[model samples]
Target: MLSVSGDVSASTNFTLAQIQALPANTQTVSFGSGTGQQTHVYTGASVWTLLNQVGIATNPAVKNDVLGKYVVATGSDNYRAVFPMGELSPDFGNRGNQVVYAETLNGTSAALTSTDGPLRVTAPGDIKGGRYVSNLAKLEVHTATSTATATGGGVTTQFQLSGAIAHPATYDLAALQALPAVTRTIGANTYTGVSLWDLINASGIQTSATVKNDLLGFYLVATGSDGYRTVISLGELSPDFGNQPDIVAYSMNGAPLPGTGFARLVIPNDGKAGGYVSNLVALEVVSAPR
Candidate 1:
């Protein structure tokens, strides 16, 4: 059985038969394995669909409150992985992650082996299988601090970049412009700034590279002057993984961000603007709780 709990309107357990009944979703995925690279088709239900069924709680008064939430998926063997709400939401990252119970290989329907499981978590967008947790056991949703208020008025000139890093530094507009520039075109406007991946690397992630999958469970929180906060999974922004081109844009249409701020967090692929935090003030790196 799979147990679901944490910050949800309903907490329940579902058996394999019940999970297989919730609108079957099929995905063809390729990832690295012990032998070599392998590909297979997985069948299950969307994680987003399951979260909705249980109802993730959010504050109606808080702007984009759901963006600050995340879910931790734990396997029976104690293996774990995390998925930020932004990455799973249809309005935002829309990654289409699945909780699979069956596999299809070379046109043959195969039941998931006991070693792999009757239930497994699969992230099709990930370049690696580190997050493809097997023998699924629990799903817990968690909300970060959300005390957003009206904009603090005026353009922000500087913001602190701290949390889980070797060197927590303060960056101003000029400091941002000095780093390598990455340009992106969004609809009619053009944005130029530093890649979020580069920015994080500059501070140096404190995780041990030798420790396998240590960084997979880490995420970043971007906060605006208004206290608006949004959580982004580190895997979602890594070039070797999800590879989404998120940036901290300082200039738009070749001009300094006018009233918005000196810098802004831009998620180019979001279907909605909830993750676009303007008047950027702080960025914090955090690890998912065990």
Candidate 2:
């Protein structure tokens, strides 16, 4: 049994038990004025406990870093909010301190017709009402990966990309044509050229012996020295005129490539761009195992 007490700017208030009765994994936290109040005191259960109760398992390998993730809570009304992962973990020591789902209010349950009632997300205690997500209908946990890539015939763990390279901030036609190729490797995987593979592979997707040959995709958002971004796809990785794509780096250059840093992925392929893709800050990969 769970209990909560707080003032909301709504015509009514809700309680934990009332929330639990609406959906198995659904929980709500309410705040704001008009239909609700602007004050922030959410009643609901901890997100961690709810996840465990719902049997949605987190990967054991990355459990320690789970606090760095985020939860995207959405409502039936299409309203949404993002909560940082750290707020819901053991860092707070209160099992019920994480995001909460509210169903009842003001000692009375909300009727089905009430738009403000039925469900909402109560943010962690430390967060203010501006952070609390009211009228939440769906909660999704999103793990942030620096990069994603295919490996062992499947996608491997995502990783962060960062490095220094000798090149101008932007490339003109002559600069793009004259730039030297860069090479890098991670674990047994090596990449030569300019494909976003390194970014994809860095995205923290683990692969086991049983799973391989998976097609992988990554969103390579390269920010220039001046804050310009260029997005490239896997197909665009092949070299131009030659077998390799112009934008990718390749071993054909006949030199040893740099080793990928700790928890990093090596990008392979070729690119005609002159600017070296150093200082990579973010990577994301989504894939299915073969």
Candidate 3:
């Protein structure tokens, strides 16, 4: 049985038959494994579609509130992986992650082995299989809640980078502009600033080299001056995985962002502006619980 819970209008469980009944999509993907790289073809329903069917609750008052949420996929062995809502939303990251029961391994209808799974979660975009959790058993969704309260003031001139890292530091507007600039465009607007991945890399994420694909289980939270927080899985931004070109923009259309702030998050492909955190204040990196 696979159970789904957390922040949904209705929580539910599903059997293998039921899961296969939902809209099915087939994908051919390859990822690194113990033996080396392996490729497979899978058919299953999109995680985003499943969330929508169960009714993901979002604050209508908050702009793109769903972007602040995340989904946790747990296997029967208690192995877990996290996916941010923004990464799953068709209008945003458009990632086609799935909960699959059928597969073609090595061009054979081998399906899933009895020991491996009757159900498994697959991330087609990942270069490694770390996020492709097998024997899937549960999924829980939660908001990346923040306690920081908004202060009535002028636009923010700085932001802090702190969390599980070797170097925890803060940066002002001038310091941010000094980093290598990465420019991205959405619609008619062009944003120029540093890449979020660059900032995290500079902070030196704390992880064990012995653990294979350990970084895939990490994530980061971006908080705005208004206290609104949004989650983004580390894998989503890693060039080795999702490869999203998200930037902490300081300027738009070659002009300073006076109304927004000296800096803001810009998710280039987001259909909504919710994850585009304005008046950026803090970026906290986190390692998801094992």
Candidate 4:
């Protein structure tokens, strides 16, 4: 049994069950948003918990480190949300209260619309509606690191960029157009008029020494106030002048961009698509070149 809380708007509020029927570990659910208030329901259990129940040597060490991961809840409306790993873990129990399946909501049997219902996710402490997807469609658990072993071998030496953006009054398009040219492009878009380096350099975030020590690879994962996500690989961050393009976010008609309530990644090199990074959140320097 897990407790969940969320609000759809100023007038609508929700506090419901976080898991559903099936079995302890064999259930699955989907979540997304729709018209009116966003709803969260449960569908079935998941293999994740089944592995846990069977005592299959689940990633005990890493399981204890859920704070570094993210949970994606999807709904039938195609709406989705993301919850940090920290919110799902239990404080006093062997594991965090994170349950992938449930049976009811608000003391009632959980139900959903043909298009949206029958399943959902309830991350009790998550405040973002985007994190509480309704329609109840999918439950995906991703490990952010490649070397993330269930035991102590999962740790990696990497550079972590943690910081905030000032949510500019307006993106200086003219200023961006005036900057010098960049040396590379990553995807297929061209940000020919802006100086991305200047933006990163000016951001007050602390850049760990690891960023400069090794040019292994970079990754960027961006999330919206809604549960939308986008991933940018190392090359996409720093594109080569041809087909690859650098990532440049634009506000609606240049209105000040909303503050990234959550931090997104920004890598300068490596060619790869960028969108909805499920597991790997940001850039990591796996190893330096010899």
Best by TM-score: 1
Error of 2 at 228 (Å): 27
Model 3 worst lDDT run, 10 consecutive residues: 145-154
lDDT (10s digit) by residue, model 2, range 185-261: 53454545443432233333343335221121212334322222233322223121011122333333343324321
Name the regions of candidate 3 deviating beyond 4 angstroms: 105-110, 208-212
What TM-score, over all chains together, does every model reach?
A: 0.93, 0.36, 0.88, 0.32
> Which residue runs does candidate 2 get wrong by more than 4 Å?
1-37, 40-42, 92-113, 124-128, 148-290
Q: How many backbone clashes does candidate 2 have?
A: 70
Q: 1 or 3: which has the higher TM-score?
A: 1
lDDT of 2: 0.35
**Candidate 1 structure quality by residue, lDDT tens digits, 200-244:** 977988886765677777888899988888898787777766778
What shift in Å separates residue 14 of candidate 3 from its native position after superposition? 1.2
Residue 253 deviation, candidate 3, in Å? 3.2
Clash number by candidate, in order: 0, 70, 0, 54
Query: Candidate 1, residue 216: CA error in Å?
Result: 1.4
The best-first sequence of candidates by lDDT reads 1, 3, 2, 4
